[model samples]
Target: MDALTRRSFICGGAALAAMATMPAVAATGVKTLKNGKTTVDLVANKVLAQVGGVLELTIKKYGKVAVVRTSKGVKGFSVINLACPHAFVTVKRSGNGWVCSPPGHGSEFLLNGKLKVPPATTDLKAIKFTANSKLLTID
Candidate 1:
């Protein structure tokens, strides 16, 4: 492995320090739906019209949810929360996954909400959803 540079070290240290002191985010403005059988009309959701498209939905009790059209034959969609489990910061889409870079703390998670990098020990919270034809019923 390559040795860490001084600049990289300093930046890393700063990010970690920020992560340690960052507070949980205040209430989100997005109105989340109830955690029950909530139906999402695919036809109405233009973003999900194409395969590989990702739709971010907000639930009443839950936080931001990332709903993606999966290419895998097993299922058509995968849904997960967008908040970083470690810092409560909203994660941004990074390549094929989600990444949280709040100050010094850096974390990455797969689209399916699996942890791909650390500073985050746990995977993102999964939101259960069932797809039928063009509609998805989330629980």
Candidate 2:
């Protein structure tokens, strides 16, 4: 696997591990649709920012993929998770895109999850986006 994939694997493992301690219901599988799409409100989801936009959503038991911009007009959007690859920190948007917490400064990322500097080289996991008149799919 490439360095970026390795990072994702490691971090993804950590995320799974963290979820292990939660209640079974928290980890229980939901209506995970392969061809279904749902809209997530960043503000309601508690992943919003002043300038940054959310890219995807995970229904815990469901699978995951990176969120991408579908169109180029008013409906255009981008999706991303808030987890940090370095130390599993719950990152946030510092200025425009992303910034890690715990007082260890200088860790920033582009809105798309590219490393802005050191300590984090892997970009955020992006999901697939498929849209049409009948449906908008995220898988």
Candidate 3:
């Protein structure tokens, strides 16, 4: 085996550090109704009460999705498909946004699903939803 170079070691460490910052919060309080709508209980997923919080889940109709808190009001949440528009690979939370990692072409999107980098010609797909004080219903 070849000896490890200092440059390679530093690069490897940097890559690991970047990956470590990605959020991996699981979906909480998810309930599928008989009528086919899905509901998330804000009380059970308290992280979503704060701005910038994200609750990731999968919907039967939409596949992977994220519910992001953009502001403090009841209407401040954004529901977006997590699949990268470029390659349809699920994006991972990175810093203040999302990144289309391996198997994708490195498309980037803001927390609200706005396109920030390309390879993707559009923003992440938005899903319709309604929110009240306690629950957010995905329609």
Candidate 4:
């Protein structure tokens, strides 16, 4: 093997740092109802216990979606589609929000799916949902 060069070492370190900063996508348990709605048990999804936590999951009705904890109440959450409105490309989590990746034109959205930057004029599509003390049901 070749000896490690200063340039290679610096580049490697930078790459590792980038990877470390990338957001981790967590999958939450889901239940599909006979009425075609989807349900998530709030207690089972520990992440939502804290504000700003997010759970990513695939729904039959909405390709990819994220359920975000916005505050501390039954109404303090948001469920949004992951597809970028610009090109229908899937946006990935970056920093405290989402960034439209390549194959897309670099739109950005807040964690709650609010539009931050454009190429995309709208926020991520919000899916109708209702929450109780123990469950969140997506309509």
Candidate 5:
């Protein structure tokens, strides 16, 4: 057998390590909600605080959704479907927005779920929600 190059060995090790961690990471921090309209009281939940606050919810009807309060004292918020429209890959937060989980796919989206990079042609789906007096009703 041929000798293994250092680069190949390192790359293989890294890939294995990432694969080992994926399942746990994928299973954690995802909340499952029944299919239907859902109400979230920010104050009562205490999960979403202020501007830049991001709350991840897994709606049975919509898969994964990220609720972000984007503005302070302005009641500006956005709900973005975290599932990649192209391949349904779970998107995760990266800097001011979100990116496809693998990162190598180069799919990125803005805070409003607009497509910002390639490999994904369509924008992420937006979930409708109303925020009033810290109460958010999502449909």
Candidate 6:
């Protein structure tokens, strides 16, 4: 309505937006395996976790996700997209169903998100998980 009011409003709006994008992400999902695809459709507040069992989930909203159940009853999870972050180019997908691309220099990572190749020293970002009851909640 006024100059000062407008400036304050704009600043407040910008801060709120920036905060939203900061990836303070909270997420939750339920998964079902179908045709080799584990579809994850749920709220961000729900977490993906290992609750004495395992689940494989593919989250469409972010990218492709992978989960594994260990022999010791442990669960592992990761997020991957074959699209290179630098150029948005499609990277080679591995037999393990992992995206093989690096952000900066030419480095490679394992499907489990471990660092492999060099020149780039970055690993894949992990998909956070939490557990409640028998549910594996991924965020």
The estimated TM-scores of all candidates read 0.67, 0.48, 0.85, 0.83, 0.68, 0.41
Ranking by TM-score: 3, 4, 5, 1, 2, 6
Relative to the true structure, how large is the alpha-carbon lDDT of every model? 0.69, 0.48, 0.87, 0.85, 0.69, 0.42
Would you list the clashing residue pairs of candidate 6?
Answer: 26-44, 27-44, 27-46, 28-46, 47-137, 47-138, 48-137, 48-138, 49-136, 49-137
Residue-level lDDT tens digits of model 4 in 27-108: 5668999999999989888988999899989899899999999999999999999999887988877667887765566677
Q: Estimate the lDDT of model 2.
A: 0.48
Q: What is candidate 6's lDDT per residue for 1-139, written digit by digit as tens?
A: 3234554455445444554553333334556445333434422323333321223334665464444332232243344444444334343334332333322233445655565654335555565664433544555
Residue-level lDDT tens digits of model 1 in 17-130: 655664433322222255445667766775665666777766665667787777643267888888898979877665567777544256878867799988899998888877
Deviation of model 2 at 4, angstroms: 27
Tens-digit lDDT string for candidate 2 (4-87): 455545544554555455332121112345545554432333222322334444545333333434334324545556677675
How well is each residue in 1-139 modelled by candidate 3, as lDDT tens digits?
A: 5465565465445445786976677777899999899999998998899999998998999999999999999999999999998889898777788887665566779999999988799999999999999999999
The TM-score between candidate 1 and the true structure equals 0.67
Clashes of each: 7, 7, 0, 0, 0, 10
Candidate 4 clash pair list: none
RMSD (CA, Å), candidate 2 to true, equals 10.2
RMSD of 3: 5.1
lDDT of 5 by residue, 86-106 (tens): 757787666667766542354
Q: Which ten residues in a row have the lowest lDDT in candidate 1?
A: 23-32
- Which window of 10 residues has the lowest lDDT sum in candidate 4? 7-16
lDDT at 35, model 5: 56
Candidate 1, which segments miss by more than 4 Å at Cα? 1-36, 72-74
Let me know the TM-score candidate 2 reaches against the reference structure: 0.48
The numbered model that scores best in lDDT is 3
1 or 2: which has the higher lDDT?
1
